[model samples]
Each structure stands twice: as C-alpha cells, then as structure tokens.
Target: MLDIAKLAGKIPGISHHFQQEMTASSQRLELAKTILQQAQNQQEALIERYQTWRDRLIFSAAMPVEPLDTRITIVPPPHRHSVFATDGSQIAPSHHEIAYCYLINVGRVMLHYGQNLHPLLDSLPEVYYRPEDLYVSRQWGIRTEEWLGYRRSVLEAQCLADMACGWVNPPGAHHEPNLAMVDGSLVYWFLDGLAHDARDLILVPIQEAWEQLKAARIPLMGYLSASRSVEGVNFLRLHNCTFDTPNCIMNCVDVEEQQIPCKVIEPLRDTTLWGENLQPGQRGPLWQSSARILELYDEAQRIYFCYVNVGTEIARIEVPGWVAEDQDLFNQGLGIMLAQVNKGFGYPVALAESHNQAVIRGGDRIRFFALLEQQMIRAGLQNVGTSYKEARKRGSIA
Candidate 1:
C-alpha cells in the first residue's frame, strides 16, 4: 500500500480549502445564535405565519411550515403496557463466495412492563438464490446486493407487524396498552430513487404492514437518533424570506456571494434546533413532513414527526398522520416512548435488544460460508473459490 503516514502528514499542509471554511463555520454559529434570539423575540408572529402557510400551502407549494411547540409536559406511560420493536441485518451477496445468494435476518423483541416485566424475542433468516432473485432486468443493471437491501427493508417492517398482530387478546384478553416501534423513518428512504417497477415490489409489503398495524390500532412509531434532517429549518426559512416564489434564488445570489440576505437562519438541522429547547422527557410540537414521497402515501398514512429529549440525545420520532391527528393516541405514544427510554437509560430497551439479536458477527459469517460450502460439495459441485483480492487480504499477515 502507499504510505498512509505520508498521506496523513500532507493533510495538515492544505490551507487553501480548510482556512476559509473554518472562518465560515464560526460565522455560521454566530448567525445561528442570532436566529435563535430572533425566534424568541418573534415567537407569536412566526407561529401565526406558519399556521397561515399550513392552511393554504399545497403539496406543490415550496418551503412548507414545520412549527415548533415547546409548551408541553411529560406524562407517565400507562401502568401496564407492552412495547415491541424490530430490526434487520443482512449479509450482502458476494460474487467471490460459493453460492450466488444473500441472507436477510430479522430480529424482534416484545417487552411487557406490567405483570412481572415479561419479554419475548425471536430471529428469522431467509436466503434467496433463484434466477429471478439473483438477477434483475438489463435496464436496471444493478447487482443482487442492491435488490436484497430493498427486500430487507420490507422484511423488517413485516417482522414488527407480525409481532404486533400476534397479540390476539386485544382489549379484552390483554387488558393493557400496546405500541410497536421501528428503528428508522416510516418513509422508505430509497423509494424516491427506485424505478416504478422495483418500487412496487418493495412498497407492497411495507404497505401491508402499515395496514395491519392500523387495523389493530397498535400505534406504530419510528425512532431516529442523531438525525441530520433540516425540514424544521426549511420551515423557519419560509417565515424569514419575503420572496413569495417557490424557487427563490435569494439565498444563492445573496448568501453565497457574501452579500448578506435580509434575513438568514444559518441552516440549522431539526435535531440541532430542537436540541436547544427540549428538556429530558419533553417533546417538541408535531410537524407534518413535506417530503414528496408522502404524496404516494394514503391520506391517513402520511408521516409526521417530533423531536423528543430521550435523555441521551434529541431523537426524532415519526408516526402516521392518523396517530398525529388523534390527541389521546399521540400523548400515549410519547409517554410509551419516554418510558422505554427511561427503562433503557436514554434508548428504548426493545430496540436495543432487537438490534443485538439481529447483528451478524464475523464468526457467524464464517460459519455460514462453511455450511454453504459443505452443502455445495455434497451436491457434486466443486471449485468454490474466493476472488484473488479477497484471498490476498485473508492471507496478509502484516
């Protein structure tokens, strides 16, 4: 390999790109402080303007408002409640390996807080190797690993929904509250990038999960830690800018050129903005997402989110519009999340446990390969060889 030490030594020698950016960093922080102070000064007017936009703005409208409401207090979760979470892990397809197959494993945990703190857990793995699964049409021209990832997302949601629906007692037998949660945003982040044909394959399963959860009224949610989304800041900009046009170039013409726009907010991420204000167990106001992907969702299933102080960090919790619009369910869901965080010490215990179950260790991969190779030999196939590059890496001692 080329000398990494020499490359590291060269990093500090670069000044042209680093110096001006460092200066800009300081300037941005100062601007953010100013924006925060201004937000405090004009809170009422800003909320008013945000409401006006919320009522009139269409899906085609630009920079929709995402208002922040800090006027709230934490409530205790129900004395007897159950929480469920699911997470998935996958071993990507390896061309260098024996079989042209990939494995998707899903882990699920259901925790009951009442009646002696009972817990249930499970893990399931599926492998795919059919010709149709191994290869897609020539138009897409992608690898099997990419397609497997799409399948994996759908499987994770299905696992959670399956666990939720398994609770047959309902209101009569259980005599307790129930909530289901996942580890990320409800919206499929990759959906917007997929072709219509590929998108349909992934969307059907996730939508089926949503339908099952809704029918059961289990109050499903998605929790994201350290989110870098800036939807909240975009809302603040809508309030700041005077331009009525959806495609305003004022920021580009003024801010980039160092001309100082009439009003600027330093482009704060939602997590950062809410981080400053939310106290432990407190949650910010619910904000409807302006993501174009939401248009594909049914009216009741549109996603909304809020930032909550989970003690360790400000995490964004997303829910369907049905959950958001229902006052009782919304409060109870937040209560359940806070309780989960409290029990787990800043994170949800169910999520943590499920992730631990889903993780595939290095040893596990080795064991899997050994089993596959043995099977291949028994089936009268030979020459199971790794790529030359992988072979070198495995044999490298230094």
Candidate 2:
C-alpha cells in the first residue's frame, strides 16, 4: 500500500519544482520558435549549408523533403473508403509460472465507411514454448523479451500486409480507396544493438512484408500520438550552429569556453515546434529519418515522417519512401487517417478496436496459467507448481 499522507506532504515541493521547469520550458520554446521563423526566411541558405555539412553532423536529425515551413491541409476522405489496422499484445515469459513460455496475440481490424459499413475484428494467438523459439542468441546474452518484441512487430506488419493485399485483390473484384496503419514506428532502430544474424532474422521478414504492400499498391502508415521526436529540432540546431565548419566532436570541445552554441535549442521537440505553426487537420513538411539502421533497409522501404495536427494533439505519421514519393497515394493516405481520427474522436477507430481485440486482461492471464498447469498435470507431470514468490504474491498475510 502507498502512504498517501507522506506523498501529500511532498506535493508542495513537487509543485514548486514543476512550476520552475515549466517557466524554463516556455522560454526555450519561444527561442526555438524564433529560430524556426528565421530558418523559414533563409530556407535556401540553410538547405545549402545542410548539404555541405551533412556528413559531419553528429546528431540524429531528419533530412527535409520539402520547404521547412510547408503546411498541407488534410483534405476530406472519400465517401467510401476502408481503413485496416493491426495491433499486438504479449504475455512475457515469467519464471514464476509453471511453464517457461510466452504468448503473442495480434488483433486485426478493418473498418469500412460510406457504402459498406461492415467492420471485421479478429485476433490471432500464438504460443512459443520451444527453446529455439524463445532465444535469439543465448551466447550473446540477449534477453528473451527483446526477441519476443521484435518477433511480434514482424508478425503485426506481416498481418497488416496480408489484410491489405486481400482488400486490394479481392476475389469478388470490389475495391475502394484503403489505407493500412500500425501502432508505432516503421523504423527498427532497436535492431542496431543486436548481433548481425539476429538483426537480419527480424529485418528480412519485415522487408518482405513491406515489399508485398508496395507490390499491391497499398498505402501504409504508422501513427504515433503525442510524439516527442527531436529529429526536426536537431536539424534546426545544425542551422543555428555558429561554426564555419561544424564538427561536434573536436571543434566544439576545443573552444575555450567549452559551451556548444547550438545547445540553446536542444530542449525542444518537433511536436512542440510544429504545434504552434500547424492548424487543425494540417500536416507539416515530410522529413526522412537519418537513423543508421536505414542503411540496411531497401531504398524503397526507408522511413519518412511528418507532424500532423489531429485536433487533440500533434501526431507523427510515418510512411515508406514509396508512399511518400507518390503524391496521390500520400494525399489519399493522409485523408483516410484524418477521417479515422474524426470518427474515433481524436484517435483512430480501427486501431482502438484492434487494441480492444488484442488486450489480455489480468483475469485472462490467471486463467491461462491455471489451464497450463492443468494440462501439464493431465500429461503425467504431477510436479507442476508455481514459484514460492508467485504463491506469496497471491496470498499475503498481516
């Protein structure tokens, strides 16, 4: 149990600290906005400088695909369109349980508006108990949870691709403007930490799914709400630097004062900077990511992102290079996304429904362990039991 009285006594101090932080944040935001406006005024010079200093940049910034200040209004979606989404939930392998296994449940949803209003909702559950399935590389000290997460992401992408392909190449020959969406980033930056073989094991399947979607001409996007991404802000820092030739490693430290000039606007995020400029239902300029992992991805599957105002908050929408390069597909994809958010009231309806389908509640987890123990006992394994710590958690004594 929590000590409410003790926590309440610290509230005043916490509030004071929060107020001080907010004041500093506001001042930094103003400075960042001023720099943004200046960049807009001298866009050409900054672009040229970025081209010259691209190789020396140490920060993970975004490469601009359009004018820095460009804002495109999201047009209304077509009367008859479909949105397909997939989300996943997992039960991580627990040592306290009777079995050393994990389960992944992927929820798939397809919502149709206008002419056809049929909505499809389903989930696919898979259990991994084999030693080979549970480990990426035990010698490399990789955790099973990390491997599970990557596997789940790959499954979600493949599921979305299969659904989109079915919609595009329907047996009945019915087609409509459709958009495919996933919950998070399309870029697998986390894979950079893994060994080469393990990373390739995950990337190959994801790339194949992307290829399937591209071949089917289906537009796909990943939506992130309340994004705190700093890609654009870091780009601004490069522009704000005072050095004739930027070298963050050696030259910045060699300065007598040891103070980096571009660090002034380092506290800002892309969402905060764009929120002040973009109106409701408008999207800021698209920017390609400079993540190192993209070098391994196919050229067509490289990720690009844009900040969009979905009325409630600024969201980051990510798409593959192919979708971003096609004007009609890009417009259609954004339109469908906006319409979905309006229907769900600030969230995408298909994603929300898919989450509902995928969620595994506490009661479900308890029952799953119970069933596993029962099956084990029925199979002549009478020693099946939970760990002492798990048993103690279930029954506490005063």
Candidate 3:
C-alpha cells in the first residue's frame, strides 16, 4: 500500500535493514540451540569421567605392601626397670597448625603419640623478609629461585637435626630414658649437612656424638617403616628377600639372609587387605609394589613395629649393613614416609591421647631388645661393653 511504501522511503535503508536483521536473528537462534545441546553432551561426559575416577578409588585396594609380622622382634623390658618410649611430630599449616607427637617404647615398638600442639604454625613469629635476605630477589630481567631453594634446604636440614635431638631424650624423663625408639635410622645427625664454616661446626659435634656413642657402646639404628611404595619396594628388591614365612614369624629370622644393613619390608598386607585396581579406580596414597603400578588407591594399614630391648642402650638403628650413600635423600624420604604412615595406620584416638599410652602385651618387651641386638650386629659395630646381663653386674645405665 501507499502507507507502507511511504514509511520505508522516510528511513534511509531502514526498512530493508530491519528485514535483513530479523532473518539473521532467526538463524542465530537455531545455531544457539545446537551449541547448547553440544555443551550438555560435553558436561555429561565430564561427569561420567569424574564418577568413574571416584568409584575406582573408593571400591578397590589397588596397592598392597609387604608383610611386617615378626619383621621386628621386641625384647621385653625387665621387671626391675621401667620401660620408656618417645617420638615427635612437626606442626605446619598443611595440618592446620598442629604439632604432631610421635612415640616408640623402650621395647622399640614404633607407635604414634596422638598428642598435638594447637595452632601449628601459629606459634612461629611472623617471618619478615629482611632487606639483606632479599639481595637476590631478582636480577635485571633474570628469574631468581634462590630463596625457595635456600629455604627448602634450611628447613629440611633443621628438621632432620630436630629429629636427632628429639630422640636423644623424651621430654621430662628427668634423666635419660631407659630406651628411646626414634623414627627412621638411629645414626645421630652428626655428620650430615655442612657448608664452609658450618661444615666444621657440624662435624665436630657429630664426631663428639660418635665418640660418645662409641664409648657408651649404645646401639644406634635406623628403622625402615614398612611401606609398599617405590623406595620400600626397591629397598627390599635390592636385597632379594620377603617376609620369612611360617616358622620365622615367632623368632628373628636372619636379616643376614640378605646380608646387608638395610631396612626390610615387613609383610603387613595379604590377599584379604590387597586387591588389584581395575580401570574403575582412582589413585590414592597406598603403597604400591610396582613403579608403573601407581596405586589406584591405598589403604593406610597401621601396624605395630616392635622394639627389641636387649635391656641395654646397645641396640640397632641402622639395619646393620651398607647404608645408602645418599644420606640426605634417604633420611628425608624415610621421615616423610613414617609420618604418612602415622597419619594413616596408627591407632585411632578421638580424645587427647596421652604420650605414655602403652598397653603391654605378653612379655614381648624382650622382642624389642632382641631387634636391637640384631640391629647392632647388622651395623657391623663390634661390641665392647659389659652386656645387659653384665650392665646390671656393673651398675651403670639402668
């Protein structure tokens, strides 16, 4: 009609442009519907993948570590003397600022003390980055990772040193503990970590400790916490051994069977506690026997490790054989593993657990002493003192 023509004519290309826009809009609407459908499909696929991962992790045991039964024999403590145990845990932010308290008995049974410090890193002074410390924060257009590296080393070394002292005496023992079972190895951190002037300082004290240990002839040994993970599997595989079956369970089998002073895996898992991770599994912290064999999932199987108290300080910490040349790596690795195991398999407590939470079983305190004797022999340390039978004969250390 004339009215429609006139309206179109009044606008410059308006009527024609509006018509084109409406058609384009219709096409866009159809395209949007297709895109939405595709997105929904992708979303469903992702959800399925996640559900599969969670299902695999929840329903399977994936990794099973070796057994630990009779791997350590605790020598029962004599009735005449009191039994003592000690262990410690560090407080950090990852644990929401709680200090972990770890313990082991005079019998050398490795156990966790559930007591902890509140507000973990809360006690530390707010660390300030001093001007002097920032000398290498960065250089013109260059990346400087020095602070992170330096700090990491400092922290690690300090922790190892702290562990050494923590084991030296349990808090408030008034005098030396009848025996202190520490985590990992018993070789005190005398010879570890030194640079330039610090080297001499570290060595001097270490030498003094060595001499003291030598004089006292006290047994210092490292404990290889049982794990089914990479390092543990390799360590045992290196020696070509497994849990000595059936008969060896009640007595100390020859660690000399492998003929090395190294920590051995105690068979702590069996067919019942272990299962394969089918594709429907997710990964977890459980120790695995294979390298490519990532733990589809892991169960924290807390086990009771024994302390063989031969009724004397002369005992074993090193498995009485050739230790790793990489001392730093070995020490750090072992400590972390022990802590993880504690977080997992150790006894569960809901309340504030006491440090001396010990339930004596059998006369097995001697098993701790026996393990100590074996450790001493493995370390190739020649004994010189009056034996425990003779220590009471001499009336020296109780």
Number of the top-ranking candidate, with TM-score as the measure: 2
The lDDT for every candidate, in the order shown, is 0.75, 0.87, 0.29
| Model 1: lDDT of residue 396 | 68
- Local accuracy of candidate 1 as per-residue lDDT tens digits, 344-395: 8888888999999898999988898889888888888868767787678778
| Candidates by TM-score, descending order | 2, 1, 3
lDDT of 3 by residue, 1-398 (tens): 26887787778788789898777655644443343234334443433343344332212221222222112222222222111122222211111111111112211122223223121110111122343333333432212232333332233223333333444445663222122223343322322332434334333443344333223322222343332222222222212222232123232244453452222222222210111211111111222222221221112211112122222211112321111222332233233323323333442111012122222233433343445457667777675233455345445553
lDDT of 2 at 306: 96
| Candidate 2 vs candidate 3, TM-score winner | 2
* lDDT, candidate 2, 1-398, per-residue tens: 99998899999999999999889888989999888888877776766777787677777778788998899999988788888899999999989899999999999998878865678899999899998898645756788888788889989988999987877786665477889999888888788877888888889998899888888777899999877789898888776788788767666766544367887866778898899999999999999998877988999999999999999999999999999999888999999999899989999999999999989899878898899989999999977989999999999785
Ten residues in a row with the worst lDDT in model 3?
A: 94-103
- The predictions' CA RMSDs to the true structure, in order, are 4.1, 1.7, 28.5
lDDT of predicted model 3 = 0.29
TM-score of each: 0.84, 0.95, 0.24
> What clash pairs does model 1 have?
none
How far out, in Å, is residue 172 in model 2?
5.1
Using lDDT as the yardstick, the better of models 1 and 2 is: 2
